[model samples]
Target: MISSISTNQIKYVLALEKTGSFSEAADLCFVTQSTLSIMIKKLENQCNLILFDRKSKPITLTKEGEELINQLKLIYQEFEVLQEIIQGTNQEFYGNLRIGIIPTLAPFLLPLFLNKLVTNYPNINFSIDEITTQEITKRIKTRELDIGILSLPIEDQELIQTSLFNESFLIYDASGTFSRNKKYKIKDIDVSRLWLLEESHCLSSQIEKICLLKKMDTSKHNLEFKSGSILSLLELVNMNKGLTLLPKLATLQKNLIKPSYIFNLVNPIPAREIGIITHPNFSKKRLLDILEIEIKKSVKPLLDKTKRIQLINPY
Candidate 1:
């Protein structure tokens, strides 16, 4: 009776499950292709079952193999969680946290919060990916990232969002050409003068709603660039000459040169809701909770607390 299996066997099985090719899985596992095939054969023999249908294109798992691999994945994730827990206790915040941040927020927001994270939890290491909101959601759902910082109303039932702060958007126009009026109405926007991030960014969609720019109207707007970072857009505005919406967080510091050409939208204002997002099944709940608390604390001082803001539903 074959009663024993090794951790090496499990690793080989998982590698095959991911790559769907024995040679690829073996390369990933740092073994010969024949070695991986032999290990999988041994595992199946031990259980008296076929784990994979080798003849199937792309290597489909057998019915029993599918269920077994599902359990194996859970076991592997749990093992990681246990390893983190043990490591986290000895040192303040030990273990790597893989996080994804939306591009618009990453540049302005990370510097504000990272220092405190390092000071408080020096043992924790970070693997950060700055990506678009769409990418963040996809990666989080696939278990590639532990947390995502995104502008909310993220509707995915598979993820949970913690509202961290409500930041306002200021309507901006080319300085001398348009009034620097504290409150410019939506209808009053010089639509022809408006500059926008290219199509995919959620920020672009929110800007369309905020400025009341019809889809066709945006199509008519001449120069189009696909960037979500307000800072870069601001530079473009300064050089190329056009108006764009900016997050309040981008404007908080006096050092950020507000090109002598800028204006704010009036009452019935527009804003974006920034929040911490995590997969519902994220393995590091305690770390996320700690991160949320720290981020909120850091952001409170940077905000213009006097201004009223609105949260958009992330459809």
Candidate 2:
């Protein structure tokens, strides 16, 4: 009975599952809304199962529909793998690659390798979304995103993580609270005057762990501001005479207000492991290999190698 179903029908069903709205799903599948609807209805008739509950605001799958969709996702992933294997044999590289990166890493890291990567492989269309670690993980699992670049180690067992490099955290002290000549220890930092990204960002959690700020009162500072951008955090830190922790790459931005404000941690230096993640069944081995090599090469010279380091988990 399954042999009667066409691949296009499967594609439409999965697209609808990914996007609840019929119009949105049609856009993804590059078909008219009516065409997509009819195809899905035909699929439902063939299977003799009421798949989506159309009465719902944003259409939702029934219990049986959910189970079938799970199997369909695995089957579609295999289809992707087969296509990638066939494409690998060809010398020309051309495909759509969707990537999700954590906001903390996106700005600093993208500049290092993205431009060259795009220019070198004009045939491959690249789409990047700067999002949180949780969103990145969710998108990768759903096959919405082809790859993720973020801090390690994510606890999800369904994904594969490849370590790229270890980036140490640095003190961005606009308050002159710490001497420039000395390597600052965690105990040296005053929690009261410390600034941080909003709690949603994984970097903020990692920084809190590194400094053991969980038990301390972070609201003791004169001003209480939560910013999403590292650039904004820097500006606020300078204006309010406060300090914040920054990943090493963020400190390398060209237009930072004061280069003298950045300070390294005392040994062993607190760091985060930066890496790429993909679903276990991801098939773009060539793209993954290329990205790993380019990113490592770009950051190798800029990252400090002499210090003893301890990794902070983002989760």
- Per-candidate alpha-carbon RMSD to the true structure: 19.1, 19.5
Q: Estimate each model's TM-score.
A: 0.66, 0.70
- Winning candidate number (lDDT): 2
**lDDT per residue as tens, model 2, 136-219:** 999999999999999999999789999999999888888876786776788888877888888888998898898787743665
lDDT agreement with native, every candidate = 0.77, 0.88
How many clashes does the backbone of model 1 have? 4
lDDT of 1 by residue, 110-156 (tens): 88888877766777888889988889999989988989998997878
Model 2: how far is 99 from its true place, Å? 1.1
- Candidate 1 regions with alpha-carbon error over 4 angstroms: 1-92, 180-182, 216-224, 253-255, 259-262, 306-308
Per-residue lDDT, model 2, residue 101, is 94
